[model samples]
Target: MSIQIGQALPDLDVDVVEDGAPARRMSTASLLGQGRVVLFAVPGAFTPTCSDHHLPGYVQHFEAFRELGVGVVGMAVNDVYVMQAWAAVQQVPPGMKLLADGNGGFARALGLEFDGTAYGMGLRARRFALYAEDGVVRQLHVEAPGEFRVSTAEAVLQALKAPEAGTTG
Candidate 1:
């Protein structure tokens, strides 16, 4: 089975590019403990849908996420350098943290990695958005293989308003 809601995220270390330099190592626990957070994963950095629609949507609606008292992070199965370059290329806003899940560590911990070698993407993460409050998952939206239906900013915002709210039930 996949990762479930309400469970505390697995403790995992991931690298991030902060302030235009490659620095800082964080764990899932540290990030979630800091505040309510949205952890969204993409197949790869700078992919078509990711660049054109998915991630940009998150950047575009980041404030709405903040107003709901949520910190946002974007993760991909790429190195910190690539993630940083992609962020700069796309002009990512300040509200979201861009994370590099090098070696697919974080995604595997969450049971979210996918084998994309057939498509030349190699082993990577799926497109998914997770809503967590104080270290516990509240909502999770994972997309179909080639679909971008859910896991968008709008979906995550709407998920926050659901009756279940932040529980992983």
Candidate 2:
């Protein structure tokens, strides 16, 4: 039931952080609309894998994404404050955005929310990344439970660069 290729992103309001503060609430359509975008979501901010590898990969390859005229965004179910702190700690680049999907509304809308209550983490977004152009998904890479591979920055970059790249699960 998750979103798929050729589907426009669902319109859901989520918090945005800019300049080390909560900037404003923005709908998913407006945030990922208008151009090429790469949006990657993590289960939580400051979590081990998220902080150590997932987010850092994006930060390191941010310029490469920008070079391709693709906007990179990081998202998590945590609040804006935690996102801001994570951004600060990760030293997120200027053109990259970090979103606070508080309440997991956006993730639920995408059918990508998972029950992390077993881990005492509550509702959270699955680790995944998608490439979209003009609001329609072109490629989607969703990681398996307790795994991280297809959603990494390098994987997405390779997909984007591939001539035959298309919708993927």
Candidate 3:
């Protein structure tokens, strides 16, 4: 079973890049505990889809997310070094962060880890995007193994456009 919309994000320590530098250890709770948050995970780093589209979408729409009062973070099953390289290559701003799930602990805890031995990547995260209020997921978009749909930034934007009424911060 995969992580559902109402689930609290797993508490684990993962690598985080906060200032366009190399990633350092950070608690997942600390990462998601700051108000509203949008977290997108890719299957791998430097891959075609992840490189060309997945991450860039989040990067470009960052301000729009902020307007909705959400902090954005990106993750993948790779290590911190690759995340740093990808961020630098894509010119990702500070508003959006990239994290490394080095051993796939977070992904495994969420039941979102994938076996990609055929592709030479061992365990990896499925393509997904989620919105969390505080630390509980309000929306989760898990994609098909080789497809992208509900996980795109556009989908997130649309979701944030009409949040529930009477929901307090």
Best by lDDT: 2
TM-score of each: 0.92, 0.96, 0.93
Clashing pairs in 2: none
Which one wins by TM-score: 1 or 3? 3
lDDT of 1 at 43: 94
Off by over 4 Å in 3: 164-169
lDDT tens digits by residue: candidate 1, 1-169: 5688878888888787655666479877886665689889999998899899988998889898888888888999999889889989877777568889989988888898999888998889889988877887778888887888678888788878783644321
Candidate 2 to native Cα RMSD, angstroms: 1.1
Cα-based RMSD of candidate 3: 3.6
Error of 1 at 54 (Å): 0.7
Best by TM-score, which number?
Answer: 2
Q: Write the per-residue lDDT of candidate 3 for residues 9-77, one digit (tens) a residue.
A: 889888998677656788989989669998899998899999999888988988988887889999999
lDDT of 3 at 8: 88
Error of 3 at 29 (Å): 0.4
User: lDDT ranking from best to worst?
Assistant: 2, 3, 1
- Against the correct fold, how does model 1 do in TM-score? 0.92
